[model samples]
Target chain A: MIKKILILSIVLSTFMVAKTPKEIYEKNCVECHATLPSSLEKMFMSYIKTYSGERDTKIAIKTFLKKPDLDTSVMSEVFLDKFGVKKPTKLNDKELDSAIEYYFNQYKIKGRLN
Target chain B: MLVSRSKDINLFRQSEKVSLIRFLVLYTILVASLLLLISIFYYQSQEKLMYAQYTKLLNTYANSQIKKLKNLHHYFPQQTRYPRSTKFKSAIYDSEESRIFSLLEKEPQYFDNKIYRTDGKIHLVHTLDTYYLGAKYLIIEVDEDRTWLENTLKYILILGAIAFVILSIFGVFFVKLFLKPMRDAILLLDDFIKDTTHELNTPISAILNNIEMIDTSQMSEKNKKRLTRIDIASKSVSLLYQDLTYFALGHKMQKKDEEIDIKALILNRMEYFFAIGNSKNIEFILNLEEVYLFIDKAKITRVIDNLVSNAIKYNKRNGTITIDLTPMGFSVKDSGIGIPKDKIESMFDRYSRFNNTEGGFGIGLHLVKSIVVEYGFAIKVQSSLDVGTQIYVDFRSKGYTL
Candidate 1:
């Protein structure tokens, strides 16, 4: 039992290391979205078109992630029916906010034109 | 003659000054209002030209932005950034006029006009033929350069000043041109009078001397009466001749100041006018105090003579003339055809006549006023029409003595 307790402590300590926002987003959001037909950049474009600003777009995405529902989904009804509604995220407010921020920076329509 | 000519020229200068001022005021108002109207139109057109130039440049920027937006839409997965430029800032709006994104210093408050200026920056809104990244309206903003406006205003001010100066010079020339005929007519009248007065002096003196040599004591009553009329007529002509001579040439004469008893002078002038007064049945009433004055004797005598002559000439038949002399001054009040109230102010003006019925030139009062002014004496006239007139010469200034 003492050996089992020491092994548990070692695993928890390894999990305790803080991840960057980009890493956090990739580990949580990209992993599941990789199976979806629409790309993550395409979803971000729909949010940007509908929400139209950095703050509103991030809030809308964060809200949808925290409580996944058909009514709150930015995806079309056909797309949702094919892929099924996403389950509610287990991430807390701070982690969800950081992930949304990283997602917005990666795909936002700024500074890319030649 | 030279002195009188100079005096006439001085009078001409005074009238010219008055007319010049009047012309300058009207001319300045006309030119200034015209300049202001021109400036307003110039500024508005300049502003329109500036806006047109800037709108053309901004439209180019907007087209480039549209091109960039199209490229981003074609490579949506690869393009990670939006386009920006240091030359200008921009924003986009959807078909419903909601802002998509803005990098502008100030948010646009209106979208109706294609181009407008606000907060010192120019904004141009361009509509895209296709929705480039859901942007139906692309708004380009740039700093509004004001160097053109500054240069325009500077040119307007400099040109306006030059125009005003040139117009003012023309105004002076116009005034001189307008006054030429009037000055020539006045000088002609002056020369005519001088020549006429110069010719009359000898004949008037000769007539007076011949009339004084006549003796009517031994003649019949009818002859004596006729001779007395001739003497009186000759004396009147002589007095008129003296006044004309003085009016034309008095300024050139040297002043001979002396202390004279004014009482004796008034009494002597009354005796001289006795025949003329008798012809009109006018009575003389004297209230003389022994007053003396230090002045040019000929000038003072002319003053007294003109006052007494005018009194007799305007007096009604059986009317009375009252002569009052004191230390302060003297007044000659006549029960005559008194001057009208409106005509009283101009009574002392040369050749101004209110009564054409009186047989004399109208230079009597003007000559009196000239001498009075030269001696720094104040003269006043009080009159009521159809009743009487009183002319007072106050001598308490430079001419008065004990």
Candidate 2:
């Protein structure tokens, strides 16, 4: 009876803890982007920092994700032909705001690559 | 002699009441219709604005998620589909419009509009530029919560009801204010008629009484004929005076409802009207039944008097008049100059005479119609050009139909 109750508690808690946006980012975004401070995602953010302001860069990231095609393409044509454009998003307002905030903080180049 | 037409002062207040109700009904319809039209237009614009705001919010949410998907696919070259979102339900479709994977149980019914609504929920289907996870159509569904709209509609209806009541009250006040002049004019007419009727009563009685008392035993036969002519003319004037008197003071007079001997009343009216018909060389054929009616005596007498007067005044020389009274009702058929078919309906309008050939005030039938309506009696007039006229009054009333 005790073991059954313990199992039930674990199941209930699992349902109770709805994934936060930061958690969602780590699970969904970090698999290919990697967790290091020198991933390709970080490199792209550094390049975006050179030409775009902080809010513009963040907004650009969101706009490109929403509609990725030849017209809004940042990658070369060769790469575009190989990988194609990204699909549309399914995040609600609460989840999307949290995810964007996570992306802004994670890949931001605050220090030198020494 | 009576100075003017047979205009009843007692009916002035009744006419005012009728006009007051008419003005109120017409004014209310105009105000309410305008208010309702404006409200409907406002509600439609408000609905459009609300939907636009909702769509903008959904687009912002979708755009953020798309960014996250792009980041995931950039570094990971072998990725197919990203992790599913837990916050809201959505579905994705390929370029062929086939569903890839959805949090929904089934595919959506249509993809025609950028925004679609289904049972108590809003659905936004946005086209994607790129095929991340091989998706072309991105659909997001949210539960509809329109308590604000419902509240707005409720407020509008409440305000409309209050406005309607307030406007109606003001309308009545203004209509009454506007009709004050008309009422004063009618009052002046009544006062004049009353004064004239009072002054003429003494002279009329004097002329009639002294004529009755004059010694005609030793008078010349030619002078006797002249006196007889005067008597006939005076009696005709007396009938007109009596009709006017009843119109003026009849309401003030006490009325008692009793079982009236209708046959006796007809016989007396015929004898009294004998001089009138004889003067015109018109003949009266009365087929009166011994029917007893339970009503006011003065009103019945006025009705019969008006019908007989009309028959005599409008008749040709040596023409015939047929008055038939049965258990059902009575009819006055005249063998005289006929009324036009189109003018028959206008016979009951006060001072409405088709031809001015005869001397009359034209209020006889108007008074008849008023009494018939009061008792819920059905009246019909049938006439043809150059043929004759017949007026039928059906006394069997269920109630006032109008």
Candidate 3:
């Protein structure tokens, strides 16, 4: 239809070209969390999967990232001592949502194992 | 005279009505618009606030449900469906929108943070994490009554009404206060006019009466000519004086309407203005008819005096001033300099004289118009430049009883 072409042409003309959530995660987040992709996602999902639901898990991760300290960390004291605590992220809300979505899609154990 | 003065007051009131209407319309619209906008914003914020409270309530219920599910999972691992909340109906779904556990049978239409209504119930959908046992979406449905919304709107309506009443009172007071200066000026002008006319009454009567008492036949022809000039000049001033006196005492003027003979009254008024016409050698052609009219004598006389004198004043030298009267109406036709078409419309306005060469204040026709209107009659002036003018007065207006 004419509508589809017009929309496509507008997209091309504007050239907004936003990065995908995965690409955004790799670009801004992976360097600090892990040298390899999916490493942080694996560790976070193992702890988060025990929560009441996906919303609770997403909220917990988001809250922890906002102000990371020993009290809020889900990791064992041994792991926390070895890896160190996570500092506040420089990423804004949009980037954070993208990165979190990328983490969920990449390494939630149910999705990866199934 | 009272009729003439009332017309002036009517004119003043009419002029102010426009400004009053403009102020009221703009003021009310502006106020209403502001109140409406505020109402919209308040209602929006109220919606958010109420929902926030509902979300907090739902969140508490959600946490309790989560804890119950955790214990149920720990002990009853073989259980298939998650437990439901007793406070409200609830359901859970997987990522594919397939219901994993639900209390209600029918599924919701949309999944968003805001509440939606369906099947006579209100519900809100929330996404929960920690996937305690694999559920992605948790929906909370409660039977919501509209009494709260109605109460909110009722409060808004009351607020709007209060603002409208308060603003309207202030608006009227402010508008009137703003026009106070203009009202005072008009009142002061009216007072000055009454005092001036009151003072001119005695002197004008004295001049007219003494001039009448003079024995003109005993004087030399040359002095007689001078006396004739004085006589015409004095008569003109006396006519103006009568008009002003009637105008000043309009409110105090007595009204005594009775059956009067129109034929005699017309002839008498003709005789009254004969000398003024004679000064210019203007001839009178009378077509008087015997007609009875129920009217005040003084007001009708003023009307006739004005029309006849105007014909004489504006007539050419040795021209004819024709007076025609029927049972229905009368007309004063003159062989004189005619009025321009543009000037005729405003000729009935006080002091709106178009013909400046004539010696009189322009109050005559305006006074005549007032009396005509009062008596339910119609008058029209037809004129063309350099040809002539005809002033017609019909006894009855269209749809008038008499």
Error of 3 at B31 (Å): 4.6
- Cα lDDT tens digits, model 3, B22-99, are 989999999899899999998988777777777787777777777765564343334445576568888766555656
Tell me each candidate's i-RMS in Å.
Answer: 5.4, 15.5, 7.2
Positional deviation of residue B364's Cα in model 1 after best superposition, in angstroms: 3.2
Docking class of 3: incorrect
Docking class of 1: incorrect
User: On DockQ, who's better, 1 or 3?
Assistant: 3
lDDT of 1 by residue, A1-114 (tens): 999999999899868987789888999999999988898988887776566557667888988887889998878899988988888898888888899989988875554433
Error of 3 at B91 (Å): 5.1
Best by lDDT: 1
Off by over 4 Å in 1: A1-114, B1-8, B37-45, B68-83, B91-119, B125-139, B217-220, B249-257, B340-346, B349-352, B359-362, B384-386, B397-399
lDDT of 3 at B162: 97
lDDT of each candidate versus the true structure: 0.83, 0.72, 0.76
Q: What is the lDDT of candidate 1?
A: 0.83
